[model samples]
Target chain A: MLIEMLIDLTLACGVVLLSCLSLSAQRVFTAIVLYVSLGLLTTMIWARLNAWDVAIAEAAIGAGLTGALLLVAWRRLCDETAAQPEA
Target chain B: MFTKLEFRKREANRRELPPFAVYALGFVVIVLSVALMFSVVVSGKAAPKLAGLAAEKLEASGVENPVTAVLLNFRSYDTLLEIAVLLIVAIAVLPARSSNAAGVAHFCSADKQDVLNPVLAALLRWLVPLAILVGGYLLWTGAYSPGGAFQAGAVIAGAGVALSLAGRHEFLWHTTAARIVINLGLFVFIAVALSNALLTGTTLQYPVDYAGMLILVVEIAATVSIAAILLLLFTELKAMVDAPREGRQ
Candidate 1:
């Protein structure tokens, strides 16, 4: 019981820490990567709660698709023209 | 005219909070959180919890899985509206067809720039089939297990994403047939609801004898549409990446 409580405590703290770090990360790319890790951690939390259905959906949609979309959007926004000033 | 960076920097400086103000805000958050937790702990249940009630009715809910029963049979109206919202999003993101061609299919024509690396190509060859198989299994297992249309659809869409990354597969979302497939889930769901109303005098209330069959049919159609819509969202967003480059050149 103590070990289980410790594991749950660690997960909850990890989630809070990762979320703060992701929000305040200097680089957008690092923030997006951290955000994906946050999603995966939430998925684990959902599983630990015995919500298998929610866990699967979170892993697939929340973490996987959202992360992929964010990465692509970041790529598009940070393209050469966007980085360079007009002549 | 200010550059975006300069404008953003100015805005940031204007909006910057003093250290004391930041601490004040943090204090407010902590106090509110404590108050909320206190309310939750003090709350008494005036009404009996619904979990017991739901369990009692589970036998009549068509599916063995309570989650499936709730989603598809018990509160199907919410599910219906959710699908409609998804359809609206899918339509909003769909690219308008180019004038030269009837559809956006030509945009993804396998040019040299679209080629995949050999290792990724080999991985996709194995993974895509496995994903499809898993997706189908999830769909089928939803009736009795934790899997369902949303999970199955997401997995299938993941396969489509892998194919898009591989750069060899062509998505023909621009075609009439593809559009039909995309809308089929919502169309079928509404039809089922209306037909149930006609037959049973209540919309979306499946007759006990036919409940399982109706739910299964609706789930199958939903899985297909959900998968198609998700794949379309990914491909259209990816095409946006190439679109600005083309216009500039």
Candidate 2:
């Protein structure tokens, strides 16, 4: 029970930190990275909840696929931004 | 009067709090309130009947892994729908032509030196294959263990990403073969579902003798497709990085 509580607390702290970072991050890439970390933390929390299926899905689709998509989109946007001359 | 104007300007220059501050605070309050409500009103063992039914049905699936049984048999339709959703998302979010060009060029030429540090590359080379092996083992033993197709696919995709980053394969991102590999999973899934519907009068239902074989085939296809999609995404990002700098004076 003590271990479980510790795990829960750690996950909660991770979620809060990631959320704050996501909000404060200036670059789109940094935000995407934080979001992925949040997804990973959520997966750990799901694992602790004994919802192994949810945990696997969260890790694979949530963190892995979603993060990749966001990064690609961000990179594309960055390129577009660079191509436009400064006003 | 000039001093008063200067002071007013200084006060105006001091930044105001962002408009999102109020929304953020409200969101936190809503979440906390919801948590409190759940704690107060939600009962323990809320769905005992459904849980009991699930437990009773588990033995008939012939899978030792409860999660696997739930995913592959009991809630297989949901799994199928989820895969479909992923495929649809991939299709919908495919980069526009300029975006695609930008991504590919970025990947093909961008400063590899910064991203591909020697130590990290060596570490990845050592770790990636081991990760693949573990993922495969987890997938193969999923019927009797905690892991399954998604976990294995993600692991394999990680290896693919590592390989791409290490520059192990030039055509990893930009090839007809890559596109085919990515689509293969959806194709295989659809084919199986259609065949099962024809053969068994139900989509995705397999003959008792061939259940394990069917699952293995699906898992392999899923792993390949996932890896391809991930690698393709990375390649697209690389293209973006290399694109704008090409024509600059």
Candidate 3:
């Protein structure tokens, strides 16, 4: 019971820290990376709560696909800025 | 009066709040959130739980997994509407296709470039097929397990995303066949709902004898449609990324 409590505490703290860091990060790429890590932490929390289905969805969609999509979008934005310096 | 006006001008230009104000706002937010969480925790005891009710009728819902039973049977209208929303998003993001001589909407005449990265190519060669297999397994096992159409579809879309990132084979999303596949889930779901309404005089009420089979069929179609829609979102956005570059050149 103590061990489980410790695990839960760690996860909760990690989620709070990552979310704050991600929101405050100056760089968009860094923020996206941190957000993905936050997603992973929540996925683990879901698993610990015995919601296996939610864990899978969070890992696959929330973290993996969302991270990839954000990176691609960031890249696209960067390309646009590079192409149109005045805009 | 002149000094006061200057100070007001400076305040207008300031982009951030004073440190004390920031701290105060943060403190207020924290306190409110904690109070909200406390209320929810205390209220949960008084709230009537649906888990018991869902469990009682799980057998009639036609699936071994309670989650599946609820999502695909008991409250299937929500799922149907969710799929409709997905279809709308898919339609919104679908790339504009330029027609060729065949009169079929084809990929916009964007330049094709092979990925050239041998490692990525080799990785994809193994991973894509494996993803498809896993997606199929998830769909098949959902009736009795934690996996389902959404997870399976997301996995399959991940495979497509991987292929897109590698810049390998071009995915054709504009074809008539692809459109049908993308709409198949919502179409099949609505059809089933109407048929059930006709037979049982109530929509989404599955017959006990064939509930499993009907759920499986719906899941299969949903898996295909979800995968296609997600892949289309990625590919179309990716194409937009390329489109602007081509115009500039």
Candidate 4:
């Protein structure tokens, strides 16, 4: 009982830290990485809560897919900017 | 009078709430929310048991797994509409890529990535097949286990994304054959449901002996279509990021 609570508490703290860091990070790329971390922490939270169904969805779609999409979009956007001549 | 005017100007320059005050207010809100969450967690009433009800009807529903019975038999209509809703969302978020246009750019993308190319290719060489295997296993296990069509489909979509990242992108959902795959679930569902209705009097009411086989068939189609639709959604966004201004068809 105590161990479970401790784990949940740690997950909650990690989630909070990552989420705040995601918002406060200077670079968009760094912020996105933090957001992915936050999603992962949230996935852990869902698993801790014993909602396996939700946990899976959160892990796959939330962290995995979202993180990949964000990184790809960021890279593409950077490429577009690089291709354009500076005004 | 000069001292008073100077004090007023200083007051005007000051923020309505100082940074310290803002932080304190945010801290308070966070604490309150945390307390609320704790209270809810501590006092949360356990959800009433539906397993018994599900168990009682499981035999008639024609599935051994209670969850599968609940989703595919007892509440199959919801699953049907859920897939339709997914298709609609995919359509809405999808960029204006033609059936043939999105395929041209990825042809050379693998060659451009000098260092990552070999690694990604080597990894996907094994990973994609493994993903397919896992997805199929999950689907097949749904009859008496926890895995199901949606889970299987998501796994397959993950594999497709990996393949895309490796620059072996198929844009499978963009091709004519792919659209049919995307709609296969919905088409099969309607056909099964209508046939059931015609045979029986009620919609989605499968025959007692045939319910299990029919549900499995629908599940397979749903799994394939769902994966295709999700991959399409993933690839459509990718297409937007890569080829924004070109190939609108």
Candidate 4 segments whose C-alpha is farther than 4 A from its true place: A79-87, B1-51, B93-116, B172-174, B244-249
lDDT of 3 by residue, B1-249 (tens): 111211122335344687788789899999999999999898877644688888898889888898899899988889999999999999888767744436534532222564357887788889999999999998889999899999999999999888777765567777778889899999999999999999999999899999999999999999999988888888877777777778889
Model-by-model lDDT, in order?
Answer: 0.85, 0.70, 0.85, 0.77
lDDT of residue B239 for candidate 2: 52
CA-based DockQ, model 3:
0.49
TM per candidate:
0.88, 0.73, 0.87, 0.76
Error of 3 at A48 (Å): 0.4
| Candidate 2 structure quality by residue, lDDT tens digits, B1-249 | 111211122234334545588678789999999998798687655767866776787666657677777777667778777777766655643455533434353222434455566787778878878978977886888888778878787777767656655654443333455557768887888888899899999987776667767867877787667655665666556555555556565
Per-residue lDDT over A1-87 for candidate 4, one digit per residue giving the tens place of the 0 to 100 score:
999889988998888788889977867799889998888889889877776666766777788778887887676656556566455
Candidates ranked, most accurate by DockQ first:
1, 3, 2, 4
Instruction: By TM-score, rank the candidates, best first.
Output: 1, 3, 4, 2
True A-B contacts kept by model 2: 0.49
Which 10 residues in a row give candidate 4 chain B its minimum summed lDDT? B1-10
